[model samples]
Target: VDADTPSACVVEREASTYSGNRGDAPNLRGPKRSKPDASSISQEEPQGGATPVGNRESLGQAGINPVHSPGPAGTGSQPVGQEAKELLLFACGVCSKRYMCNSKLVIHKRSHTGERPFQCNVCERCFMQLSDLRVHQRIHTGEKPYTCDVCHKRFNRRFSLKCHKRSHTGEKPYKCKECKKVFTYRKNLNEHKLIHSGEKPYQCSKCSRAFRRPETLKYHQKTHPETTAPRECEG
Candidate 1:
């Protein structure tokens, strides 16, 4: 029989009989419950004696097989026709996003609920994950754990170090889809996009003149130094 065929698979429900002894298996014989709906079965449950309902080929790719099992039966039970191998997935209630484990799902739910459990002792700033909180604490600690081999420049985060190395390699990985122009940094590419859209988001407070870059606006503001307010003392 083809493994992919749904009709080829058969579910064998395990049954136990009571002998009124401590070592005896619990009596499962009761009023016959209806067959469990394939969709309703919890992924956390053991897959023993469970038969998948759909085509094995398509289900195998998704890392889960929709199992269906009949109601309780006699003590004598046969093995399931096909082995049901699946990785159980835990889904988020708010966003419907799925994870491999309940802990990951709990962590992912924080993004929707805005729950930050881990906090930095120095800044008292909270983060959703412990790793993020640890990284944030580095700002107060002044710890640069990641170092560059080329220029000996150090960065607090590994990603910052990776981007820094690209400067030495002359790697311009970020490309403008419209003009096919490449940029060393994603921020520069984003700023270049403003030229195509003709959007000058940074406007001078002193005048109606606007610029695509904040630095350009700052340069323009230099012309209005007489009108600009004096800097307050830090004290």
Candidate 2:
């Protein structure tokens, strides 16, 4: 949970040499890191300090370029240590703290990472990292930070915002070639294809009826007392 009041506007902004590594998610530190190129050196993390960049200049804070340290110049980022002239920039907007090494910087970056590492073992879905997964396990304890930009809708992740955007745009880029029926997105296209193909991939073990859509199949299972026809016949 964030401590800063939502009404609090940024007081000051500073720039420094602390663009932390972004190979992995800052919030979701995986059990093992993906193997990176040998020439590449992941920064350990920089010392802590406070160096302002600018205040209230744009829609968001100004961020320096981020990458792993190297031996010398001739590339985008600076070489390891101070030998590189490029100014290292690192700081957390939430708390006025700057770091040099990518490690500490990543830790600072975690606040912005909005990492949700926790996941449901039964569901096999991934999250930001273990700690976040643990915190989210409480969702099985009921907690929600998500808020709806429109009427009264809220969700846990930004992806939900993307899903909700469709409602406003009414843009369905995906379309069925056989029927020319447009859909919201690619996943919908796959689901829609089942309709024309008459492919009832989802079957209810509790009952004998088959369903083209997963949700439809789920709803049909409710009538286990007798053989009820699936309303998703439109599928």
Candidate 3:
């Protein structure tokens, strides 16, 4: 069987049957989110911080096209042969997110199931996919395969290298709808969204300080004597 072939025959059958009734189809991961316009993204020099911009040239290169996205959130209907591919696709029951590749769907299913089939031999930390395990292994092995072409900094994962490349290219693909701020990555925008909503999900166990982001909460917790005692010795 081809490497891309679904390991399970049952999933292939289910995906094919899923196509019979589009109305009954569960939600699937759809196209990439639309980006802000190009004029908003262009900068003379790259800098840290999120901003809103459009034009998906950068995201398109990353295989996240807003137009051709395959999930339910797509703006238009699937392109030619996409429907058939979906029929042969595996979908997540929780989110109804579909994957054309069975392996991808299997890995995605782990997000819901919290199943970690892959584990690190050294630390015994678990991962949902073998690729993730391999990346985790890099920490123990001190292996950095991916490097930044500009600054020569190295990374264990290819995506990290890609994100670092943005520092050089000045690409900010994620944007905020309210303040019109642009972000180099989507997670930064998500963190920024909490500021506007005034939603504080990360709360300190000691001081009862609420934070929009976990990093902030973690930093705030350091002020408490109990948490910083161990780190003080390590340093």
Best by lDDT: 3
Ranking by TM-score, best first? 3, 1, 2
lDDT of 3: 0.81
Give the root-mean-square deviation of each candidate in angstroms: 26.8, 36.3, 37.4
User: For residues 116-233, could you state the per-residue lDDT of candidate 3 as single tens digits?
Assistant: 9888989999999888899999999999999887899999999999988998999999989999999998889999998899999988888767988888888887777764455455
lDDT of 1 by residue, 23-57 (tens): 66553566667877766764434377454454466
TM-score between candidate 3 and the true structure: 0.57
Q: What is the Cα-based lDDT of residue 11 in candidate 2?
A: 25
Candidate 1 all-Cα RMSD? 26.8
- Model 2 / residue 192 / CA error / Å: 1.0
Pick out the ten consecutive residues of candidate 1 with the lowest summed lDDT: 8-17
- Over 79-184, each residue of candidate 2 has an lDDT whose tens digit, in order, gives 7666542344665567756566666666556667775455577555666556556555645655545666675576655566677778888988888999999988
**lDDT at residue 30 of model 3 (Cα atoms):** 72
Score candidate 2 by TM-score against the native: 0.36
Error of 2 at 160 (Å): 0.8
Write the number of the candidate with greater TM-score, choosing between 1 and 2.
1
Candidate 1 has an lDDT of: 0.79
